[model samples]
Target: MRAVIADGKGGPEVLKVVDLPVPKPGPGQLLIKVRAAGVNRADVMQRQGLYDPPDGNAVLGLEVSGEVAGHGPGVTAPPIGTKVVALVASGGYSEYVAAPAGQVAPAPEGVDLVDAGGIIEVAATVWSNVFMIGQLQKGQSFLLHGGASGIGTMALQLARVAGARIATTVGSDSKVKIARALGADLVINYREEAFEEVLADHGFVPDLILDVVGAAYLRRNVEILGVGGRLVVIGLQGGQLGEMPIGNLLYKQGSVHATSLRARTLEEKRSIVRATTDALWPLLASGTVRPVIAHRHRLAEVSEAHRAIEDPEHIGKELLVVH
Candidate 1:
């Protein structure tokens, strides 16, 4: 089988596709014949030597849409040849991958199978952080950073369906309009204005914020939180370290949480998968929310896919056709 790996770590140039023995599933795992895989920021970070796979595997993808070619010991239900999408700890950028059965779900009805490759990771992340952890409720205000991003786009749509008052920050004016069209009640072009100030001026105090910018916006995020607000930090594209505004947090009775889906345990991931499938599949089936694909590249063009993900103008998910 062919798989993508970072030869060393520096840039997208380091990524190379090489031949590798196909993996057989272990107990409770499913052997997935990869069709397409999602290209994520974490994959870029891994290539740049910033992030390491939890399982110490060098393969560079996190999610794939494929078929259950076979099952491992103790796994049976999904059955052979079932079309599915899976969230894996590593090794998604390959012709085949072994994923824990619990982390796999039937591809949503009505979505193209290849496009479904990009759906699971973002859906699981948003469901776990925004809905399950942040507990965003109907009528509450929600704010998301990187409005045009894969995670941002998913968060916006889910929050909209949840009946929340949605706000988002994007890098360009065109993305601002796209965010608005995606049901965001407020969209700020961060290149032109500070999101905190714009949101405040609009009197939109978010009860919940899904942030990817990390340290760059921490203080401002806290300052703008509504009473008893929850802020979940899931990415650190800006930087890793930041000073917490203890006084402001105390005054507003706010809470801050930082989490990463890639670092979570299999049990936790399984639970997230179950919840995400149950809550999001119907929405996807009905076209209430969808995976936004900004670019699709063949497996051999992995370097180009990585570069596309790092482009600021890129909106939505990047996918690698593996089949």
Candidate 2:
């Protein structure tokens, strides 16, 4: 099998394709013949040596769409040859990957199997952080940063379907249109305007905020929250250190949570995957939620894929087709 390996992590130039022995499934795992793999910000981080995979895993990828080739002990359902998409800890940038069986879900009906690779990570993250951990509910207001991002795009549609008033922050004017077309009730160009002020001007304060910028937006995120608001931080692209104003947070009764899907225990990831499959699949099948892929590249062109992800003009996901 061919897989991508980073040579001493630095930039996209460090990624190289290499032939390796196919990985075997472990207990309760499935050997998936990868058809497509989602290229993500985390993948870039890993390539740059900023993020490390779980122990023993070195390849770079977090989600994939493929067909089940075989199963390990105690695994049964996603029978061999069944088309599926899975959330994986690592090793997805290959022709074959071993995925935990419990984290694999049948490809959504009406979705192209190749495109489904882009859905698993965003779906699981949004379902877990925004809906489950953030406690966003119908009739509430939700704000998500990076409206044009893979996770942001998915979160926008899911929040709309949940009957929440959705607001998002994008980096450019063109992205404002894209975000609005995806069901955002309000879209702010963070480059020109303050998102908190925009929300306030619209007579809304978000009950939940899904943030990727982390520390850079923390103070304003707290100020813009409605009473009892929850801010879930899933990415720290804006640097990690920041001062928290406990008094303001206490006054608003706000909560702050930081989480990462990749570092989670297998069982925890499985649970999130199960919930996402149940809650998000129907929406995807019905076209109420859709995969937003910005670009696709051959698996061997991983450097190009990584470049596209870092390009501000790129919206949504970049997929690496393996087969």
Candidate 3:
């Protein structure tokens, strides 16, 4: 099997296509012939040596969609030949990835396998952080950072459909229009505008904030949170540390939560995936939740895929067709 392997840690230059032995499933795992793999910020981080994959796994894809080529002990739900999307601990950037059965779920019936692969991680993160941790409700307002991103676009639409009002912050002016197209009620251009001021200008004190840029927005986010609000941090694109006002957080009755799907325990990720498949699949099946795949790359052009994602001009999910 051909896989994009990383040499030590560096930039996209570190990624190289090399032939490797096809991985086999261990206990309670499934050997999937990967059709598509989702490239994420974590993959870039892993490539740059900021984050490392777990023991015995050097590959770095958090989500995949493919066919079950084989299975191991105790695996039963998704039988052979079942088209499915799955979350894996690592190694999804290869032609074959062995995933634990617990972390895999049947893909939406009508979704193309190539596109279906890109949906798992985005949907998993959204379901867990927004609806579960944030406790977003109808008529309540939620603020999302990076509103035009693959996860951002999906999050905005899901939040609106789930009955919550949505607002988003973007780095570009064009993305504001794109954000609105996807259902965000207010789009603040953070390049030339202060998100805190813009939201307050509109009388929007968000009850929940789904933030991707963590440390950079910390103080402002804390300032914009209404009483008893929850701020969930999904990414640390903006530096990872900052001096925050603990007194204000206590006085304002707010909580800060940081979550990552990749490093979660197996059972935890499984439950998240199962819930996503159960609640989110029907929406995709009925066209209520549509995937926003922006670009697809051949298995060998993984370097280019990384470049495009980092370029900021490429919006939506970037997919690698491995099989």
What are the C-alpha RMSDs, in order, of all predicted structures?
A: 0.7, 0.9, 1.1
lDDT score of model 2?
Answer: 0.91
Name model 1 segments beyond 4 Å from true. Answer: none
**Decoy 2 TM-score against native:** 0.98
lDDT of candidate 3 over 36-137, digit per residue (tens)? 999988889889888888755787788899899898877765778888888887798998888989888887877899998889999999999998888899
For lDDT, candidate 1 versus 2, the one ahead is: 1
Q: What is the lDDT of residue 144 in candidate 2?
A: 92
Query: Which portions of model 2 show Cα errors greater than 4 Å?
Result: none
How many clashing residue pairs, candidate 1? 0
Better of 1 and 3 by lDDT: 1
- Candidate that scores best on TM-score: 1
Q: Compared with the true structure, what per-residue lDDT tens digits does model 2 show for residues 213-238?
A: 99999888888888899999999899
Writing each residue's lDDT as its tens digit, candidate 1 over 139-181 gives 9999999989999899999999999999999999879878998
Ranked candidates (TM-score, high to low): 1, 2, 3
The C-alpha TM-scores of every prediction are 0.99, 0.98, 0.97
> Candidate 3: which stretches are off by over 4 Å?
none
